[model samples]
Target: TIEMKADKTLSSVLSARAFNALMMVDFWNPIYSWRRAVLMQYVPGTASFDPESSRYDLEDAFITNVKKSGLYTQGDRESLEIQFISLLEVELEQHQKRIQAYLNHARDRLKTSEGLLGCLTLAESRR
Candidate 1:
């Protein structure tokens, strides 16, 4: 079992978002496939792993770290918030595009399978 410390900034951010961690291990076993149990230790400020929230947090961390590193001109909190919102919008748009593409692919595959099934039925009827 490995123990890890959460980043102080991330801990503070998560605490501000109302996440308090209890010392526990979340067990996971795939109902249909896996029989082995996977144990995950819950650490403070790291209990939940929501991808969308994680993405936003990562962006926020990146912006703050970059600003602190003096790589870019530091903006006021309002401006930073605006920038973060814009970044989130862009990310959401990209995710939507990916979802649409996946749906289109599934639709195309269904069409192809239907066509193949029809051909097979016709062939079997003539046989």
Candidate 2:
């Protein structure tokens, strides 16, 4: 079913150059989604929305791009922002959990190494 849909979408952009152009559009769509997801979490607490600040600039650009997409024109800006932030909260929480797990793993490895060193020191003393 997906392959059939891809074929239908491909007909309009038949040549390699045309397909390349289409691919760029396809690639940025997910990138934009990811940017929106990340910015939604951080932008609200930021002190400055000035262009000089990279985070603010990114947030502004994402909002501007979404506006031009014409999909959420019916919703108020605040509503849209809240919706996006809530939509990705679970994903953000899961990301934090993953980072914590990695840290715990590192700590565990350090403890194991310390124990091995203690045992080696005892063996050397006995010898």
The TM-score that candidate 2 achieves is: 0.24
Cα lDDT of model 2 by residue, 7-100, tens digit: 2333321333322322232232433445345334433232233334322233344444444444445565554443442343344455456557
Instruction: Give all candidate RMSDs, comma-separated.
Output: 15.7, 18.8
- Which pairs of residues clash in candidate 1, taking residues 3 or more apart in a chain or in different chains? none
* Local distance difference test, candidate 2: 0.42
TM-score of 1: 0.25
CA shift at 31, candidate 2, in angstroms?
24
lDDT of each: 0.36, 0.42
Winner by lDDT: 2
Specify the poorest-scoring 10-residue window by lDDT in model 1: 20-29
* Local error of candidate 1 at residue 119 (angstroms): 19
Clashes of each: 0, 0
